[model samples]
Target: MPGSAPLTTKDGRFGYEAAGDPASQPLLFLHGIGGAARAWRGQLDFFRDRYRTIAWDMPGYGGSAPLPDVSIAALAGALQDFLQAVGATNPVIVGHSIGGMIVQQWLAKNPRTAGAVVLAQTSPAFGKPDGDWQKSFIDARLGPLDRGETLVTLAPSLVNELVGDDPDASGMDLARDCMAAVPGATYRATMLALMGFDLRSALKAIAVPTLVLSGSKDNNAPAPMMAKMASYIPSATYVELEGVGHLANLERPLAFNAALDQFLKANVTATQVTA
Candidate 1:
């Protein structure tokens, strides 16, 4: 990591572990729910020399302080503040799953982004929970955790579907640990905020270069949904990684990184060519 430091903002202080060249373009990573900045270890390791790679624990997760306010907009604001606190201006953001939705919401409130990579995010509004899946997800995850169920014990079962099948034993444990570390209230608040979010209308308004990556077998945020989101964004490029679920970046890091590197290079080059 080029610079490892703690970030302090008006809302709270955040710990960010960074790796890469200080002079390179900054790339900010936002992990999914139950995930911390460390979730981007693979990415940071790969891109460090070429780009300034930094990932931080969001408020109420990992090393950051708890945030009682859990609204999507509030989360977005906190992210924005964190970015400023860390001195990343016009950064390229890569977000996975719930983190992806947070990026969308972040852009909605403040669209001055350099670029974005949205991976396997659910719809802005998860829409009305269908069948028992929604309620079941809530009951199994949010409800128990809120009431004092062991977060570590309860997190894996709740997000098992999001993780691809055939995850290595070590990878599975990492996922569980990340989820467990998140506070119960934060988890519940995030889920509730996700339930009512509908960002379809806001998509077309985004003007930055964007990439939407989908996991071919993701039940949590299916390919069709990512496609729908792509259609709404005039500048968005959509790609589906085969044989992976929601966590494509984690499940298939090499392929995902290759695609990402290509997209970012092409986009940055085109911008320079046009400029």
Candidate 2:
């Protein structure tokens, strides 16, 4: 509720929503492919009292400009710029789905930039681009857009598939609205960019405290896969939220926030005290 207002970076190239004390430790949220900054509204409100909570619209989503070349590295570079623009130092970064991929990419390049990280409903690898499974996965998502169906028309059903069976009505509406608002070109490019993603080798290099969260019912990033990913990270803790789906934050905000709080208290707060 606090970060309901839209905001832009000092240069106006990136758009986001912000709440809480600017001087406090920052909590930066990155949404999934189907989400924009508004997708983290619950998080911004929940964490506002203690942290400078901010949710960003990734490049080409919402009010942000499109990246000239969409890739994990490019998105990570954009994230670095966004962090500098916002004046966040060693922030707690939370990312979902493809957003999590971007987080991994950033950490690979700037290993010491974050105090902690939350990777929810995401994978360390997208699989080989030429693999049968990967090819089918890309085609299934792109086929709809290639057929001239706009995201506005396809969003309802697309979002429905990513949520749990007993999803909150308001959450469903929010997910649909955010997905519908994505530019078709951006969505297409993002899907293609994912084809080349492979961060399996970078997992062990994550030196900061990390939380790998998965929805038990998530089909996109299965619980077992996320668990394996956590095993590879030296300082990682894995959490599985039962009855939730790919849209963990939206599907079950309380559970999602609780896991995040636990990580913050154990890792972030203690780090602050030691510093």
Candidate 3:
């Protein structure tokens, strides 16, 4: 999806890659902490002819500017700014991992901002900021960087651990490349950002069609967690991919895209939904 140089927002605070007709319905993809916009090549290509498909690099990744304060709310504001700059309206957003968290936060404020959303491989809460699970999670991600190893060196192992039982060879390679490109500092910031996330209460307030897609093998955001999350959202539909892991979109892109496309057609494009 990325061109020779990434496309920047009017304020130059965000960078994104886009395809398809700009005047068409907006279909934006937000990558996880380990990924940049280029990681969404499959999604961009698949939806390019049908919608204005755009994939964005989170602030501080790729050509996007870094945020002074990194919180779920701040990231949500950045998302709004980026979409506005690109003239995207009534968008159908697909968010993975932390990207999903940002969508939840954005909807918390602007309940009707999106026409529909897919929250894939994500959770509503991370326990507590200073809890053992939170600490261990952050430590695990940042430990290698602290030991003087770069993401380039650790990407192979990290990606290996995140994939499912069935994975595409090319997708695995792209996942590694995206993880390797992530700056260590931004990764650390985002990991810490997860500690403060507790959007369980906000789930019920979302006023748009939502898909809570999960992987049975995703220990990070387990299937049960996603199912419970779906139960909380009034308009949510839950779907779990068997034998899949945390990186469902990358590992099982075909299935992931199928589920997402089906949800969009049923709730958004093929039907008229109020946003």
Model 3 stretches with alpha carbons more than 4 Å out: 1-5, 270-275
Model 1 TM-score is 0.86
Ranking by lDDT: 2, 3, 1
Per lDDT, the best of the predicted structures is 2
Give the Å shift of residue 215 in candidate 2.
0.7
Taking the tens digit of each residue's C-alpha lDDT, what string does model 1 give over 1-275?
33344444444588776776655677888887778877677788887766778888977877787667777777888888787776775578887777888888888777866655544455556665554666776666556655767777776785576766565465566677777787776776777766656788888898888888887788878888788888988888888877777766666778778888887887753111111
Rank by TM-score (best first): 2, 3, 1
Total residue pair clashes for candidate 2: 0
Give the alpha carbon lDDT tens digit for every residue of 105-147 in model 3: 8888889978899999998887787898788888988998999
Task: Provide the global lDDT of candidate 1 against the true structure.
Answer: 0.73
Q: Which has the greatest TM-score?
A: 2
lDDT of 2: 0.89
Tell me which of candidates 1 and 2 scores higher on lDDT: 2
Assess candidate 3 and give its TM-score to the true structure: 0.95
